[model samples]
Target: MMKTMKILTALAATMATIPAVAHEIWVERDASGPARIYLGEPAEAVPEAGDPEFHHLQKPQAIQSDDKPIAFVRRANHIEATVPGSGDVRVRDDSVFAPWKSGEKMQGAIFYARAGRSETAAKLDLELVPAAANADRFTLLFRGKPVPAAKLTVITPDRWQKAFFTDANGGVEIPKLGAGRYIVGASHTEEGPAKLGGQDVASVVHISTLTFVR
Candidate 1:
């Protein structure tokens, strides 16, 4: 209980230091193969104004559904990979963006992304886990505890978007979710004195997304 309070306090101190809404990273995948990870807004798909250069994606991991580690292939506009298993395939890049100046302090960010809504355990520091297999309702967690009243943004496959807030228990439900890929994003910032690329930083940010097709 004390640890959760400390984390929540640290988050409150740093959330305003950096704006979490910006070009985000997300993943789209099929059940057995072909996962394309993007470094920009999904509304444009790719090669659009909001999309950054695909090369900006750093060493992101393809957390598989099974015990075996799947391989990734880098392409010109996106990272391509053949993923195994029928469950959710998660991806993350701790160094997607290099440490940069946020006014006078150096700030760093870590992006966490998922490509399915199947029943999957939390693997990243921040994740949007489905309530059940292929469920639309989700729970937001920080260090494995509910994060009350956090903002969660949902982008439907048709490019419609709406932001929802988590309840006291960090739970939210996606309304009228339909076919195609959906991207759900949330972020958290921690007051930090941490190292990135051998450089120290004042705060570290975490942005997470859950993308799944109905």
Candidate 2:
């Protein structure tokens, strides 16, 4: 009993270090017809658009029938993107809080246009893409390479969430998905160059998300 209690205490402490936001990005249509970009957790509640921590790492990219460039319109709560043709739009928030005394945090977002499925818009730190051969399978990439054994959390249209791990090639297969809209998320952390609090350190967190409608 004492050993079990000690294990439980340790687990609790470890979980405390995790952030409450667990940010994610997705695109949804607004009343004006243009797609609006959101940054937050879709599984729990509407993204905290007003969260001060939400900021673009770089200019957002959009690929549609014309391959036009789209920019993020920063609003009081959330950001918006104008997709002219509707192919794929992506945004990266690189090292949003890098050089922190604790570590660095980054985010990537991908939106698949209803017209076709394709690769990520921007190959940032991490990426989640659909498998070429199977619609139910997916591939997770870290630093533009396959990431083996990475954890993937999937949220279905009905708000059902499940966790999965990648195979040797960073591939994951979801046997059951009736499909509507789905959000796939993956995160990885490693030791990397960082300047935090005026001191050099080695720690970074990379988070990526893929949002699609079937």
Candidate 3:
């Protein structure tokens, strides 16, 4: 467990830093081919924005499913790799953006992403997972425990978004918006000594997203 947590910064902790960049990282794979990791908003495109952030992905080629390594390559705007199985594919990047000032304190940010939903186990230190198979219910957990009252943003396939807070169980249910890709974005803040781009930070913000087709 200690070894896994070490690699986490090094994916995040508490309220994340997403205001400045407004960019997010996620993975996508249809019946067409390999899973592709992306850095941007779900329903919108930042136009060549992903390539620049691609360099910040320093973690080894990885996917939580099966605990095996996969080779990811930089494409025109995203990272692509062939995953091993149908299980969820998770990705984390700690150095994507430089730490920025958030109010009185300077904060660093870490981003975690999952390509598939419905996988119940918590692969990342923090994540949003389906509470049950064949249901729209979901839960936000940190290290396998509920992250209660956290703010959650749901982005629909049509570039629409709605924001709300989680219930006591760290759970929320979103009515199926449509027949396209959907992304649920949530963040938490952890205070401690951390580094962003090799610089010291007062606290680290973790931004996690769950992407899946409805």
Best of the candidates, lDDT: 1
Backbone clashes counted, model 3: 7
Better candidate by lDDT, 1 or 2: 1
Top model by TM-score, which number?
1
Which model, 1 or 3, shows the larger TM-score? 1
Choose 2 or 3, whichever is better by TM-score: 3
**Tens digits of per-residue lDDT for model 1, 1-214:** 9999999998887765543348788888777778888888666657743354455686887665467766678776778777766667778787776777786899898888888776657987899988988887899988898888999888987889999999999999998767887889999888969987677999888899988888
lDDT for model 2: 0.59
Candidate 2 weakest ten by summed lDDT: 107-116
For model 1, give the RMSD to the true fold: 9.7
Each candidate: RMSD to true structure? 9.7, 7.1, 10.1
lDDT of 3 by residue, 1-214 (tens): 9999887855453334434456778777775468888876666764675644555555524545465667777777777887776767788878778787666777888888986776777878789888776368888998788999999888888879999788999999987888988888899999987878888889988989888887
Alpha-carbon RMSD, candidate 3: 10.1
**In model 1, which regions exceed 4 Å deviation?**
1-21, 48-50, 64-69
1-214: candidate 2 lDDT, tens digit per residue: 9999999998787555444446655566523356665655668656344543456323344434455566667765556676665455555544334333232442222222221236433345576666662267777777668899998887887889999999999889865676676777787776666553344556656666776666
User: What TM-score would candidate 2 get against the native?
Assistant: 0.67
Stretch of 10 with least lDDT, candidate 1 = 47-56
Q: State TM-scores per candidate.
A: 0.83, 0.67, 0.81
